[model samples]
Target: MVRARVLRGVDLDVPAGRLTAVVGRPEAGKTTLLNCVGGLERPDRGTVHIGADRITGLGDSALTRLRRDRIGFVFATCSLFPTLSVEQNIRIGAELAGRRTEKQWFTTVVELLGLSLLLRTRPSALTAEQRQRVACARAFLNRPDLVLADEPAGELDRMEAAALLGFLRMWVRKLGQSVLLATRDPFVAAHADRVFVLAQGRITGEVERPTVESVMAAM
Candidate 1:
């Protein structure tokens, strides 16, 4: 038995300790591309490799395990357990992956995201920005090799979006982790170390040290 690939001949590389942005208009297959990279959707052609593992060839169970252990994902929507305290929610990823949270790293991430004071609060009690930060914490708490974020700042205001992007970039550099962020906003793409422009299901161009103008031009 075989499964058909969902994507065409798309090639991408997210370098370690760098934040790469995939920018495109809505319905331009940005989510689909991100999903394939995260192993949520398999491409019909090409391969997706995270670190040393070629994830595209793995079976469902293996892919699931690999994603759980080596990758983290943050989406546009807030994903949180309303009844769970922030600390409990943040630790869920490590627990599910059969790993323990490293105290120092956890502390560092919490402080970096300004989540220390909100540790005891539930998701329902937090502001939109705070909840999103908590989601970021959960994604990074396990210290995964790579993180895939799909429009993570879509719900935020301009200032909050800028802050979130800054936080994401800082953490990627500090932890030497790779990140693939998908977005339609040039403002958001400008925060990336490099940006790839996608259009009509294909990569149209690449921009280095992207600015809003550069990213828009690339698109």
Candidate 2:
């Protein structure tokens, strides 16, 4: 594997079932940290373990399979196949995991995201917020080991952003899955259970139960 040499003597253990905010300024290496955690990038000096499995040493095929089966992503831009309906778009996650969609999981996701009625609609027919909501539903549908979101709400309006954050909080509380979200937004970072502020490729500070006031002062 081509290990990504980013974490130099850096150490952080994310507790299960919590929303972890990786926050820092531009080029602060927040995205790189998320990539490493999600196995999109391997750590050169340290191993990444998801439970008992050492992810950093996995072969390409093994890593690919691990990512497909155990992780989900929400990029800064909403990545979806516009030609596919909302249902089919969401289906792609489970399909990649090589698991037939669980009916209960799919139904719960659609209802939680209010996408059941829009399942037949195309991506172009929806607003940006709607499109992102579909993406969220898809990511959660598979019950992944970890969810990595890079600026997932960066494009939304204030109200939409708040709603998105609340939705993520609910996921953490209800689904019991860990989420690693990287963003530059102070308000968004405020919602996390723990906030790690990176600077010059190192974690400069940390705030437990992050808030806009606390995180801003750290930055």
Candidate 3:
């Protein structure tokens, strides 16, 4: 059997209350890195820390608890339950964690994401952008310590993608949330406070306060 190593010596920090991005082409180990950090996949070696707790060697149950209480995720696909209304979908995160949803925060997230009018609608009824907003709102509703977004705006059109990125930026700046977004798009990378360029399973370069041109150059 051949063992493939996807990420090699990738060390980076996601500061609190900021948006950090990893930009890379397809098969550059971007998704693998996120999975390891999020505790969905355990690395062969290395450490992952969330706040003061080291999660690298934790057991499955411990990792589950950590994820439930501290981490949020936004994937390329807006993975909402088709049977549930948007409001139900958003609330389900809290429900699964056995936590009560704070009414004020819930309302705030809904309004900020422009989903107030669509709460009662099911995921299938939404446009691509609207469904993604619902996903964003659900991820932020808990105010998790860290949010991992993997190609979150990958399927949206230019205008929709920009709007989605703007909302992500607003949450980080105004609400003191931390986000680590992984994408192949330079435009998406530009929205981050700092960008890490990945290639062939390694971080090749970094650009602080990245512009689209700067990120493209780094790539």
Candidate 4:
């Protein structure tokens, strides 16, 4: 295995309004790459640009602004406040983006995520699937330019994964939001318009979907 690097000169472009799936086996440096791009971690080499803004080189405060104002993330873990209601969690994101007064945007995200019925429920009261959906809704509530999701469906069963992936596809298409998702599951990649296969921190191949059985076989 190659020794870890801060950044490994991997260049990627995620166009607007597209869902790009990044697939790699265990320990393929998926989270590292995401952290660099998301401005959560600084890279030793190379630059990460979200449109014209270079995220990798930004100072801590600037990176925080970039992430909060322009990007969103969904992790495998539920990072929402346990004490806050689902709607409040979602609303906070919008508030940060200065859109808290926009009822239309709030209602749109809630309706799209089917969270109207669960608005009052706290994170502790929700099931895993419901919590994940709320996470999704919270990420979209701010209308971010890009979203980065790591291992989003790793814990869900096949049926639930399919449903969640489909909702992500719809979210990308209808909201004009771009997404980069990292997963090991072929089913998750099946929902993306394109897939990049990573191995030992290098992109070994690219596959376009709806994938053929032969394409899935390669993974």
Better of 1 and 2 by lDDT: 1
| Candidate 3 C-alpha lDDT tens digits along 153-218 | 999988999999999999999999999999999999999999999999999999999999999999
* Candidates' RMSD to native: 2.5, 2.3, 0.9, 2.3
Worst 10 residues of 4 by lDDT: 210-219
- TM for every model, in the order presented, reads 0.93, 0.93, 0.98, 0.93
Off by over 4 Å in 1: 1-6
List the lowest-lDDT window of 10 residues for candidate 2. Answer: 3-12
Residue-wise C-alpha lDDT for candidate 4, range 51-86, written one tens digit per residue: 887676678889878788778888887678898899
As a whole number from 0 to 100, the lDDT of residue 62 in candidate 4 is 93
Best by TM-score: 3
The 0-to-1 C-alpha lDDT of every candidate, in the order given, reads: 0.87, 0.84, 0.92, 0.81
Which consecutive 10 residues in model 3 have the weakest lDDT in total? 69-78
TM-score of 4: 0.93
Candidate 2 residues lying further than 4 Å off, grouped into runs, are 1-7
Candidate 2 lDDT tens digits, 1-219: 874445455577777899998888887888878888787877666778887787887888998887777887887665989889999999896776677987887898899888889999999999888888888887888888888889988899889988888888899999897888999988889989999888768888899987899999998
Residue 23 alpha-carbon offset, candidate 2, angstroms: 0.4
lDDT of 1: 0.87
